[model samples]
Target: MGAATTVAQNMSLCDKYTTALLKDNNATNQYTLMILLVNTAVIGNYTTTPAPKNAVPGILANGTFDGKAVNLLPYFDGSLLSSNRGGSSGVSVNFLDGGGAEPLKKNLPANDKNSHQYTLLTHLYEFFGVLLQCSEYNKNPAFPAYAGHDMESAHRFMDLSPSEVGYFIQQVGLSAASFGVSQEDVTAVGNSLNKLFGYRCSPPTVVVPEQGETLNSICQNEMCPLDEKARCDLYPNNGTVVEPARVNGTGNSTGNGTGMGMPNATASGTPGFSGAANRMGEGVISLLGALAFVVAL
Candidate 1:
């Protein structure tokens, strides 16, 4: 793509997200709105349900959450190889004694922005109309339109039980919700994922606390992402609230409906998150800082 096209693609999708975000004047509320949307999806119970509260302990005990050790189940669909999903790009992990949950990555750059191959962030970004060229996405002429990039294909091999599908959505949804996505968007994403699973997890129940656990306490204690800085609150947010920008009109990218206004939420929250002051401002700084810090590895 030419420079102008690239710029337009970047800004067009960004406008969709920022337009969605700046709708809320208070930066914190923006984050809250995001979670509400996400909440509807992971636990939407649109099709399947319960997510087995008793199962969480076993998964946690097995050190399977947050890519601690590879489950090699839900990914590697379509043309994608094990490396595309797993830390397969020469990635090295160092585990402390009983530290499977927090294994340290030794990969130089787990994700490369300049590369055409869609790494994690890049692949996720395209969901919001970024139009990145993914080496693993739709490379084969025989691959389907969204092929390796689609959630259904990714999880198809797993043949996940309804509960496993619910758990998968919950984990991914909670990860995005932490950044400030809403339940509507989260549900949109979840609905899309559920379709891949034949609505097996429709009407899914989000992973709630066993008994004594509260929302705050469950996430505060149980969530595990690569970023240690991720927290229970609208994270990567500015310390103070800021006035919402007067963004107007709608944002459409790549001439497809698959732009920022996606049905269920997934990657629309990446607006201005690269630590660039020219974008969404300071709210994204800390999150980007954490991301950059990981890149330093």
Candidate 2:
């Protein structure tokens, strides 16, 4: 948390997140858009290969929303990592959103630069996209189009239940603390993540559980090589078994499409809910920071 906090705080004025972080275009907010990009790149999210390149600048240049460009490339390049971490060689991130929501929500057109949510989601999507690409998940037989990293894998592992997803969010908090990421930034990310999970992306997603099948079984079943490597790397000697989701009738439950569904609502409005979305988001940032530390290792 300390290292990450420093990075967030020390980010230059031009590097902060577009809104709050940049007050009067001079005041520096801890969590800036550039911080997200820097963290994403540190975790090896940006692609340097390919003809046109999916590097930060190109992606922002090509992607737009609400008639405005989402370009933050000037603030981030392969050089940012070298300046901050003293090295430029990137590495594959070992962590992933257990619920698989990151991959699912990443491609939503609504999340494009047009929506207010774009700034936050961009980090989420790019971080996960890069993770998927650099990891074995990109190579899974289920997603052959990504063989050359041209296309992102579209497999859904609706393996996590609402409660489990919440737990993942909590993990982000712990991870962030360990890495010295600021609590304020973590809270902001938490709020954003909460909104993200319950965001109800356009063209609702429906997941049909395999009778008695649970999220844990799916996450644990025929695990991809990338996931296996990640689990080992992240958990190491600690026998930290991933938990399963409990779908009783409490907490922010992502409905199963049929009848057990609910719109994306906050914990205040909804009963038995604990705002797991924000937790998940904060954890993601923390995990990214942690991964960046790993890369530095």
Model 1 residue 282 distance off true place after TM-score fit, in angstroms: 30
lDDT of each: 0.23, 0.26
- In candidate 2 the C-alpha lDDT for residue 118 amounts to 37
Q: Clashes in each model (backbone N, CA, C under 3 Å)? A: 29, 19
lDDT by residue (tens digit), candidate 2, 1-297: 122333344542222223222233321222223333343232212222111111111111222222222222211221121111222222112122121123222323122344322333333433333321222222344212111110101102122233323323333343233222345655544433333222212111211111121111111122211232232222212222232223233322222211211122221222332344233332423333221211111
Top candidate (lDDT)? 2
What is the clash tally of candidate 1?
29
Q: Candidate 1, which segments miss by more than 4 Å at Cα?
A: 1-16, 20-121, 128-156, 187-193, 196-297
Tell me the tens digit of each residue's lDDT in model 1 across 227-290. 2332224321211112112112322111111111212211213232232211221121111111
